[model samples]
Target: MVNILPAKEIYLQGNEHALLLLHSFTSHTRDMKKVAAKLHEEGYTCYAPLYRGHGNAPEQLLQYNVYDWWQDVMNAYQFLLDEGYQKISVIGISIGGIFTLKLAQLEQLEQIIVLSVPVEKEPEQLKQRIMDYAYNYKNIEGKSALQISNEIEPFTNMPLDSFIAFQHFIKDTMLHLNKITIPIAIFYGERDEDVYAQSAETIYQQVQSSKKKLKGFANSKHLMTLGRDQEDIMKEMMEFLRMNNGDLTQ
Candidate 1:
């Protein structure tokens, strides 16, 4: 039986190696729970934080923006630091992956694991996609496009101003990719529907990190963290952590 308490951050105590996990936008920390458990089993401490306006009703998300989400990431990182863990690793899925890359530019991380991150899309392209997604819910009874997007969407009912926040983060991260020197492991599913698989190659080519690797999963999708290859993903992540000399000083 699953525990259905109110949504909250997950903190698992383990060895010296600490992992700060971030989930996708509109998603709660629960999405990272399984991966956190796997890492904890390997003697690694893990923390997964719920971003503002998440883990509750979908309508709550409309009040937040990318900055709020990023602040959540920073807070989680600081919490781990306060816990006296020196060596830290970061992992994120989708938008979470984007935040992890951005965070690496600002902090010293042992390594970063990115799964199914989207490439920066052109302005018109993004606008059209968002609009198309909104159209799907426009006709649903008692469910406006925004409300529906808040809950389940390829595009959320996120306002233009809020949506632009994410675009800004993506643009900023792209500019600073050269600043990320830590080892990075990137995973992309070949059949991913949300993000282009080519994004993995683009990221691999732009990062200044000498120790970076990109791997493709033949049978996974955009939600690779919760997909069919989760076990394989976890195995690969464990190997990556080992190869990067993660401080598992238990």
Candidate 2:
């Protein structure tokens, strides 16, 4: 059995307006910490949860389904609500973006910011990514070459139910985009692949939010927050929030 690696879940107390940040697939909350910290510096409460089965062995990832992650998202949102933050927004990237859209469908969110989302189906690529994660993760764990191959070989061609469920969840979220009426800002990196750019356009066109903005950073890519245009994108994000009742100087 793979032991769970320790993860750092961040919560910075600042103001009544809270921001919930979600990370990508095969990632931890650290990916969103920079954005959360940036917002916290401006007097905003920020919480980024480390999802279950993540920050651990890649094999452990296969043990959890999309349902597990959804519960994590719900719990994170509920934590904010219980903290007396009536107004809450979400910023999600990749799989986190998927959750943000799904959350908007049922939750009373103030607004949403989605980055580098893959709204379309990507089962094959996802499967390959899982395999790659497993290989790289074992290497990081200091496992020998024989051990890594032995561990990954069993699941290389096997049918993974978690990934199938994840794809279904994405498709399910796409059908419910019209349910979201809050303001939305979708951003992508010009340096990223065509899939992300197309996904951004799809989200912009499909969400029922009347106030939606779609922007691309010239020097950024899929992981926009860590790209060269990170500062510029964050500035634009703040501006978008300020325009949409995010002037939290209160």
Candidate 3:
């Protein structure tokens, strides 16, 4: 068994259910604070787990792998269970979305909201660009106001081994997609240059869940939750949770 790693939580007392929010790669729990606040107002407890090696010293990230991150999610889920949360849903952004999907495979989740999940292996050109950016051969650009806050000024340089491990995680997750049985809502940006929009489309088509919805943000980018249409994204999330009776509003 993998060792349980430490995580942070933002709890908003509500009914018996809660929403677990997971942030993207290299991001801190602060990345989901705004969303957590809004969800709190609507009556749901939001627990945002800071993935291992994120929101801290960059070097710490080098010591971890995707399994370590997954272990953190497991620990968070157990925490919620111990707290008497009977029904739980998850909302994850980017790499967090990948972890949410993996969680769905292991647990009987009420609902899942995935934003900008990277389902495909990085394309050659994109991989090269990332490498260049990491090595200081190119500058990292921010496309929206959300990006401005979430973006690392110099862009955190990722270890090559970690990047390769991510590819494995994606591959393993996709192979297990058929095992996910929860209601799923996926959001993708049509203009997203980071993760291919096709990946979201594939997930929408491939998942066997009877209840699933896919929405595209035409003017947004990879960071859909942090981009121009974030409010819309949140609105859709609220509606989905309500429809499933998973919303804390009720």
Candidate 4:
């Protein structure tokens, strides 16, 4: 049997300054749910869009590339801009953070926040594990193999094409890091299992933005938004936005 869970978009209306929240690769809008709620309470309109091929059947994910996901992010931002929101900020987690950095090179916005972004290439061992799981999905001990696999990692499997696309995306995004002059804040987990701990500092050093901050959180893993320092992370994001006057012009 298949697990046909519903994946919904999140939109909260508040002030003029809107925030576009992006989830990690293979993750649904649910990853940004809590953060969106907090930012909404802080009087900022927020949107969390579900990326293409995500929150669906695992095989369907193979149909998309990193550019497809970036298009989804652009659509969400355009929706806000069309709705008369002038001041816009973007907050991203993991792969979402990579996308945010990519967008920083392309667009001029209010500010950006990248949490636990991978500045370097992903390990081949990890990619192999995902490919292995995809190959053995039916043999897994579960009713819904895809769903069960997603419980372990956001995506049940990683297709070779998508993996390659991610590598290219990272390489391309890094090449233009000097183009980002907008205020940016980065957060990293000291004990992150997926990304290296030094990634935050690496990004902090690469960007030409004078207004930048690198923060490391203790006792948090790859899922920094959902970890022990969740509240603290939210507070820092809120403070960062406010410092940029994101609370004004409402």
Question: Which stretches of candidate 2 lie above 4 Å from their native place?
Answer: 1-5
TM-score of 2: 0.93
- Which residue pairs show collisions in model 1? none
The residue-level lDDT of candidate 4 at 230 comes to 93
The TM-score-based order of candidates, best leading, equals 2, 4, 1, 3
Please write out the lDDT profile of model 1 over residues 91-198, one tens digit for every residue: 999888999999999998999999988778554455554354334324433565565555555344334665676787788887888888999999998888645577
Clash totals in order: 0, 0, 0, 0
Q: What are the candidates' C-alpha RMSDs?
A: 4.6, 2.3, 7.5, 4.1
Each prediction's TM-score versus the true structure: 0.84, 0.93, 0.80, 0.85
lDDT by residue (tens digit), candidate 4, 135-224: 454344344666555554544434456666678778788888989999999998888854556677778998998899888899888778
> What is the alpha-carbon lDDT for the whole of candidate 4?
0.80
Model 4 TM-score (2 dp): 0.85
Candidate number that wins on TM-score, 1 or 3: 1
Scanning candidate 3 in windows of ten residues, the lowest lDDT window is 133-142
After superposition, the stretches of candidate 3 with alpha carbons farther than 4 Å from their true spots are 1-9, 122-159, 246-250
Q: Candidate 1 — which residues are off by over 4 angstroms?
A: 1-6, 122-158, 246-250
The global Cα lDDT (0 to 1) of model 2 is 0.86
